[model samples]
Target: MLNGLKTLFNKKSVDSKFGIALRSQAGSYALDKGEDTDIQAGEYFTETSESAGDWLDDLLSSHNFQGSGHLVLSASHYYNVQINKPDLPDNEIPSAIKWLVKDIVPIDPDEMIADYYDSPVIVSGTQKINVVCSHLTSLKKYTDSFKRYQVDLEGIITDEFAFANLLSHRKHSTLIICQQPFEEVFLIIVKEGQIYFSRRLRGFSDVGGYSTEQLSKGICDSLSLEVQKSMDYFERILKQTPVSEIKVLLPVKHENFIIENLDKNTNAQVSKLDLPSPFEQMRNCAASVGGLIEFERKGAEND
Candidate 1:
């Protein structure tokens, strides 16, 4: 995902554009023509090796992603940090605050592609914003490939925004946990269709391989602690109202076991996320499928 490239969509263009989810090991595609999106889409993957650059050309060179497109870099490729808003003009925010992001992510500020989304007013009436930082060298590998192959890159997003798009507008906040197989878990809170908070929880990448036996053995109880910690920060620290719902798009068969345990242990209700239409069926690539759906707003709003 690159900065300063985004498009507003028309109904017909949804079929022409492509949505891709790029991870360390694989790339999955989705088209928004209603049902059978999987039939219309394709993916490029490699398991034995850990390369991510030109191999993408094999996937991008096809007619699949021809026009303007959107891409969701999986959680491993990027990170989000919520910090106090900098008192600067919009044009200066990137340079002024990228250092702040560096303090948290440990990357050289020059080589990081950073962007921000404003969070809700904190309980103390202080303004806050979330900064998404990606590696410039790593991200340009894919974007340069897109340019060489003539795919007009529109917008870049993460699974946090992609998965949050599935929720229907609600009066109260809902926290959603999402993962695709070996990817890190991402937690996001949405209410009335707006993203209020997001976090990337480490470990648990192999949750997709978890069996009924493993979940029943309580391998996922630490997940409750992560969920509770996030809820606590949102309620007690941010001073926001308590989130009452928890949904998951984790794409595992035994996901229910984790959900059941979370429901019993955590403060809010927990359930498996009910993805919409085409995404619901392709649970593993739900975030890529969601890229086909238009964003409620740009991921980096300060731009």
Candidate 2:
């Protein structure tokens, strides 16, 4: 059956060298703990009759990215759960979003496939948790897209972690607004070297989707709105402190809006993350190169 072919093809494949290049733009940096590098990468999912290893090998060959020891963290998801008394399994801990915004919004717990990882918090007594989940079918489709791109996926990583890695080097509270295809917008808030929160906005691009110019406009507007919203939420609800500075990283081209808007709004420092260092200019695929570099750093530390 076609379903079996698909299941058979979804087996995990490990590469020791590159660790799996994430879906990233050329020259996009992915910081693992702290080192930076250029990367050429893509993301895809498995399909009927397509073995993950075969698809990955073909992708590497076509793209010409080295793949000797790359490893993809496939089928990975992130979610947050508080460290409550251990009566039930940790899985019993409800979604972090549910805990934070339960009164504000009702979420169908079963609808999402959630996972969690513990992280250190700024306060010594408390712990920060990252919760990641997505519609199961949707997650699979995301993976499949990488397979479709014919790029060998060394591993799978959540977009949140990717964003986290991108912002790891930054200090002070920071906000990241990214405009994806179809006018989808993602707003991330980070502080003390970790993700504090995030929000997504849809249909903010073109009415139907995106055109080159329309996407540019959407990026500008979305960044402005998300920054305002993040500032307000941090002050009013979280009641801690608002981000002192905001940094915007774009794939290029539309970077002007990020600069212009920041200049117009409250005094927050806004700039591009993609070009943190001038060396980033030399690489064509920054994210992929960043991925490889991050992997290399981790590998080196382990040894």
The TM-score that candidate 2 achieves is 0.56
State which candidate has the highest TM-score: 1
Cα-based RMSD of candidate 1: 4.1
Q: Kindly report which residue pairs in candidate 1 clash with one another.
A: none
lDDT (C-alpha) at residue 207 in model 1: 78
Error of 2 at 167 (Å): 2.7
Report the lDDT tens digits of candidate 1 across residue range 1-303. 335434322222333656788876877877643335333555668764346775677777654556555789887788777888988898888677678877799789888778887886664677888888888788777777777776766788887777876777698989998887667888888888778778878878887787878765766777888888999988888777899999988777777777888888887888888866544577777777667654323423534
Worst 10 residues of 2 by lDDT: 1-10
Tens-digit per-residue lDDT, 88-180, candidate 2: 455565434444433332335555554455543433445455544444553454355445544344444444444445565656788876542
TM-score of 1: 0.84
lDDT score for residue 106 of model 1 = 70
